[model samples]
Target: MLQLVDFIARNRFFLVFVLLEIFSGWLIVRSNSYWGATYFNTSNYYVAKTLAFSNSAREYTRLGEINSDLANENARLNALVATLSQKNAKDAPVGYVPDSAFNARFTYKVAKVVDNETNRTNNYITIDKGSADGIEPDMGVISATGVVGKVRFCSKNYSIVTSILHPQFMVSSKLIRSNEIGTAKWPGKDPNFVDMVDVSRYTKVYKGDSAVTSNVNAVFPPGIMVGKVKSVTVHPDQTFYNIVLELATDFRNLSYVYVVKNRQLGEQETLKQRLGDRR
Candidate 1:
C-alpha cells in the first residue's frame, strides 16, 4: 500500500493528464454529433468483428459433430428412399403394403472415423462403432458422397475398415451409362484414383463416365457412386480398357461414414452355402 502511494505520487501529474484527456474525449463525443457517430461506429465495428471471430471459432470446434449429424440424417433419408422405391416396384409381391411388405434390406449406421490412412499401399480406416452398434466385418462403408470401404474387423465398440484405397480391396462396379460390369481396385499407387478393371474395350465408356456399385452386389446396394472415370485407354495387349477413376470419397477429408447393414446378408450367405454343398 505504501509503495502504491509513492508510485501514484510520482506519477500524479501524468495521471491527471490522462484523466483530463479521457474526459475531454468523452465530452467531444457526447456534444458533437460527428464525434458521437464516429465513436459508435468504431465501437460497433469492433464488437461485430469480435463476435464474428468468436462465432467462427465456436463453429470450427463443432465441425465434427455437425458432420456426424448430417451423415446420420442422410443415412435415414437414404434408407427411407430405398424402402419406398422397393415398395413401389411393379414386381413387388402381390398384396404388398408399403409398411408391412417392405423389408429393410439395408440400413445405415453413422460413425465417426477415429483414424484414417490413405498414403500406404494398403490403407485402412477405423471408426467409433462395432458389433455393439451392429457393425459387422463384411458391412459396406460409405461417405456422403460415395463408397469408402468395407469393415475388415470389429470389436465391441470399434471397427477397422479396409479402405477402398487398398490394393486387395475390390468392389463390383459397373458403368452408369453403358451398364458394363467391372471390378474397382486400387492400383497401389495414387490415393486420388482407383482402377476399374475388366471393362471391355467395346463398352461405350468415356472419360467422364461414372462407375457405381452394381445392384447385384450383396454389400453395397445398387447405384452407390464409386467414381467418375478420369481416363479410359485401350491397352495394346489386352481386350479390356485401362480405366482410371477419380474416387468419389476424399479419404483425406473424411470425417464421418455410414456402415451399410444388409439385413438379408446372412440369409443370402446361408443359401449360397447350401447351393455350394449341392454342387
Candidate 2:
C-alpha cells in the first residue's frame, strides 16, 4: 500500500495534465459548431455502416429460403406453360403450322439425384423417386438443359437410370436443321460425346447441328433434345454418315432431373400394336 502511494504521488502531475487536456478538448468540441458537426457526422457514418452490415447479414441468412421458393415457383410456371402449349397443339388442325413438338413433350417431375456414376462403363444414376411417384422403367429423364437418360428400374421409393453414356443406351435422334435421323450410341470411350450412326451421307450434315429425339420408339417422346453434332466423318467405303455428338447434358454435374410421364402412352401403344397385328 505504501509503495502504491509513492508511485501515484510521482504520476499525479502527469495524470492531472492528461485529464485537463481531455476536458479541454471536450469543451472546445462542444463550444465549436464545426467541430461538433464533424464529430456527429463521423459518428453517423460509422453508425449507418454498422446498420447496413447488420441488415445485409440478416438478408444473407434468408437467401436460401428465398432461392428455394423461387425455384419452386419457376418449376410450377414451366409446368403450366407446357400444359397450355400441349393443349393448343392438340386443338390445332392437321395442316396448321405446328409448334415444334419438342417443347410440349418435356414435362418435368423434379427429383434429386441421390447417387450418380460417370467413370464406370455401365454408369447409372439413382434418383429419389420410384413407382409410387409415377416413375417407371423407360421413362425419359432429363434436366432443364437436356436429356440425361431413361429410367431402367424402380422400387417403391427409388429409381435407377441408365445414362446415355452407357454402352447399352441407344436413342433415336435426328438433326434439328435437316431432320436426318440416326441412332445415337455411346462407344464407352468419351463420356461427353456420343456416336450417331445411320445418318445418310446424302443429307447435308455439319458440326453444331442440334440433335433431338425422334420419338419413333415409344420410350421417349419426339423432340426431347439429345445433343449437338460435334464432328461428322464420312467413310469412303461406308454408306451411312458417322457423326460425333456433344451431349447437351453434363452428366458429371447432374443434380436435379425430371421424369416424364405421358398420359396417353398406354392408349397410343395399344392402338399401334393392334394396327401392327392387322398388318
Candidate 3:
C-alpha cells in the first residue's frame, strides 16, 4: 500500500493530465452537437462491429449442432416422402413407372460420415451411427444426391458402410430411358465412375441415361438415383454393353448420409428364412 501510494504520488501530474484530457473530451462531445453526434456514431459503429464479431464466433461454434439438426430434418422429409408416395403411387399411369419402390415403407435415420475412402481398392465408409442408433448390417445408406452404400457392420456407437466403389459392391440399377436392368459395379480403379454390366447390347442404352436403383431386394428402395450413363460401348464378341456411369454421389465430399430402414424388410427376410429351411 505504501509503495502504491508513493508510485501514484510520483505520477500524480501525468495522472491529472490524463483525467483532464478525458474530461475535456467528454465536455466537448456533450456541449457540441456535431461532436456529440460524431462521437455516438463512432461508438455505435464500433459497438455494432464488436457485437457482430462475438455473434459470429458463437454461431461458428454451433455449426456442428446446426448440421445435425439439418440432417434430422432431412431424415424426416425422406420418411414423409416415402409415406406420401406410397399412398399416391396408384394414381400414376400404368406400366410407365414401377410402383414397387414407392410402395415400400421406409424409416430414415440421419448419420454423419466420420470417414470415407475413395482411393482405396476396397473403399469403405465409416459413419457416426450404429446398432445403438437402430443402424444394422444391410441397411442402405444414401446421400442427398444419390445412393452411397449399405451398412456392412456396426458397433455400439459406429458403423462401417460398404462403399459403392468397393470391387464387390453391386447395386441393381436400371437405365431410366430404356428401362434396362444392369448391375452397377465398381472395378476398383477410378472412383468417379461405376460400370453397369449385364446389360444386353440390344437394351438401347444411350449417353445421358439416368440409372436408378431397381427393386432387386429389400436393401434399397427402388428408384433411388445411382448414376447417369456417361458412355455405352460394345465390342464384337461381347454380349453385354460396357456402360459407364458417372456416379451421382461424390464420395470425396461425403459428410452426411441417410440410413434407410424398410419397415417390411424383417418380414421379407423372415419369410425367406422359413422357405429356405423348408427347402
Number of the top-ranking candidate, with TM-score as the measure: 1
The order of the candidates by lDDT, greatest first, is: 1, 3, 2
User: What would the per-residue lDDT of candidate 2 be over residues 1-279, giving only the tens digit for each residue?
Assistant: 999999989999998999999999899889999998998999999999999999999999998677556545655665666556545654357776645553454455777789999888899999999989888788888776677889999999999999988999999897878878899999998889999999999889978999987746556655667889999899899899889999998888876787876655677779989999999
Per-residue alpha-carbon lDDT of candidate 1 for residues 55-107, written as tens digits (9 for 90 to 100): 99999999878876788799998788667666675445788675533346889
lDDT of 3 by residue, 1-279 (tens): 999999999999999999999999999998999999999999999999999999999999999999989988988887776666555654357665545654547888999899999999999999999999999899999998889999999999999999999988899998888988889999898999999999999768889989988857477767788999999899999999999999999999988999999877888899999999999
User: What lDDT would candidate 2 get against the real structure?
Assistant: 0.81
Whole-model lDDT values for every prediction:
0.89, 0.81, 0.89
Best of the two (1, 3) by TM-score = 1
Pairs clashing in candidate 2? none
Whole-structure CA lDDT of model 3: 0.89
> Would you give me the overall lDDT of model 1?
0.89
How much is 43 displaced in model 3, in angstroms?
A: 1.8
Model 3: runs farther than 4 Å from truth?
Answer: 1-7, 90-104, 203-206, 273-279
Off by over 4 Å in 2: 1-106, 215-217, 275-279
